[model samples]
Target: MKKYRKVSREFSKHTINALRYLVKKKIISQMLGVIAVGKESRIFLALSPNGEKLALKIYQIENPSFKQHVRYILGDYRFRKLGSTWWKIVTLWCSKEYRNMVRAYRAGIPIPKPIIFKENILVMEFIGENYTPAPLLKEKLPQNLEKAYDNIIKIIYNLYHKAELIHGDLSEYNILNFNEKLYVIDWSSAVNIYAPNARELLFRDIKNISIFFSKNGVKIKPVESVFREIVGESISQ
Candidate 1:
């Protein structure tokens, strides 16, 4: 574990400062170490003032690599006017993720509990036991493909019907395989059902999952049926 360092709270500040701001905001008190430095966000193991362990995800403002986020953010109706600036897009992306996660949580979907979020810092409940992040589904394929496919399908169902949302970008990468269960993560691209392109995104999400499961030998019906069943709307062939 790396020692926790003090830094600035704003995105203009170094990443450490951004983390410090999260601590001061009571989003997290301190961090044990960095977990994963991903493309969009860096994950860290932190401590609450009350001593509970938390996960801090700091979105890089300066030098924020939004190379892959372009498609999803541009697709959302809520993120219009995010001009060509990279930081502006990153800020909006984090806000979207926090809002979507909160909505999903209220609807009883299995999402990480969001603690607090600033312009770019997001503190959330850590899914792992000590410090390690839960492995992604791509890393840890479920031993039984059938059960894994079922779990993912159920999650998609709840996300649409209960949360009234669609994960605009989802795949094995955004799904965590932990404690013999499937936990959805990386909600930075999730969009509400009222979004203009919500159904298209949902169909894409289901199709990706179906493709993965099929490759693993789990039989799945067409993505169409899955989408209709989840949203409770019949569609023409």
Candidate 2:
């Protein structure tokens, strides 16, 4: 497999071996280059055996803040038992993201389609063209701020009422503006509606989006009003 740019060497040998396993399985043909990096993971642009573009999100095994993720996992009914080790925790976190993406995609949310996940790596549909990632919403705001604001609100509503999931972290940073289309990314922090902290997370998600749009002159409704419309109840109710 050919690697393009030099990525962080902090990746564990286990993650390197996992990449080899995927190649052997014919799941990915080549690793083009690093697409983006985040606090706990690195995203790489890759190609499938059929030459289709894919995004490989590899969670860092040695992430110092891996412990902070325990709250998201513990309240998730899907993950009843927490992992005993850091590697295990990161691996489960990767799997959780894959499952969350599947749920959101199936529910008609505009998210990258999750292909598969192995170990600490998650393979999904590439959201950009020609190995270049789409600009983030914060980087390039759409021309029609009103439409963009409405679209995001619909996504949040569907995430709650349809997918039964809460995007615990929803902000311009994690949202992509691809040719004026909005695609929400980063699902590891998403939690089910019944999660213990779901209400708080959902409120925060709505508030983040509302704050962003309002600041950009979208004339958004109050955060509580939007939250109540989605969940069918006031935040304090």
Candidate 3:
């Protein structure tokens, strides 16, 4: 929690900028609640003037040591050639996540739809209902194993083939099990299948996912098979 505050402070300038942009753009006004203070972002549950609820993610670019943070985030291929202004890189990185989320949502990948993205703030569809956060997959394992396994496999296939993306941080931590349906969040680490390190990222995602599901009582294959299927041998791991 303290870490989140420390990071959020980095976005002071960006947040102020986004707020000005949002208000100027006539986006949102009412405040409902705060969802979570994640390691890298602060999430808020807000209400619009018309009384519709929404989720907003505020990204932090400070912490001093965040210079190398890009190595860990997903979909970095888009802004690799951009000059090395740390704030610019970080801001672009957040924007990249928003774009990926929009793509995923369009491909029916069960990701939150991006409402708006400006500077470091991203507004998205709130995944929860009734003022509660949709439970993380870690906290909400399914009672029916076969059905859940099939759902997991289908989503992985969709994200891998149909969406042409690999969710690099696809552990239970990033999956929301809402009302018995699975929704993926935290796309900051998602990457295109053709990224230079795509195979490596895909393999790690598979390992993280399989390990998490197995611990939750669903057995899955090794990362190699997933890599072969998703990345193909010609991609060069």
Who wins the lDDT comparison? 2
RMSD, every candidate, angstroms: 3.2, 1.8, 4.4
What residue runs in model 3 are displaced by over 4 Å at the alpha carbon? 1-11, 72-77, 232-237
- The lDDT per prediction is 0.77, 0.90, 0.73
lDDT of 3 by residue, 1-237 (tens): 233344334447667667666756767665454688886678877666566778888776664544655664534557556536766766776787898898788889987778988887889888888899899888988677557766766776788888887777777888888888888898877788777666777777777777777776776766677667655663353
Output the lDDT of residue 219, model 2.
92
Residue 77 error, candidate 3, Å: 4.6
Candidate maximizing TM-score: 2
Off by over 4 Å in 1: 6-18, 63-85, 232-237
The better-scoring model by lDDT among 1 and 3 is 1
**Global Cα lDDT for candidate 2:** 0.90
How well is each residue in 1-237 modelled by candidate 1, as lDDT tens digits? 134543333236545655666656666666676788777678877788788888778787755457766666664666777757765666677888888899888888887898777777777888976667789999989888898888888888888888888888789989888876778888988877877667788889999999998988888988888878887775343
TM-score, one value per model: 0.85, 0.95, 0.86
Give the clashing pairs for model 3: 74-189
lDDT at 135, model 1: 93
Sort every candidate by TM-score, greatest first. Answer: 2, 3, 1
What local lDDT score does residue 106 receive in model 1, on the 0 to 100 scale?
87
Over all chains combined, what TM-score does candidate 2 have? 0.95
Which residue pairs show collisions in model 2?
A: none
Give the per-residue lDDT digits (tens) of candidate 2, residues 1-237: 545213424466888778878888999887877789999988988889999999999988988898888889876889987889888888999999999999999999999999999999999999987769999999999999999999999999989999999999999998999999999999999999999899999999989998898899889889999888988899898
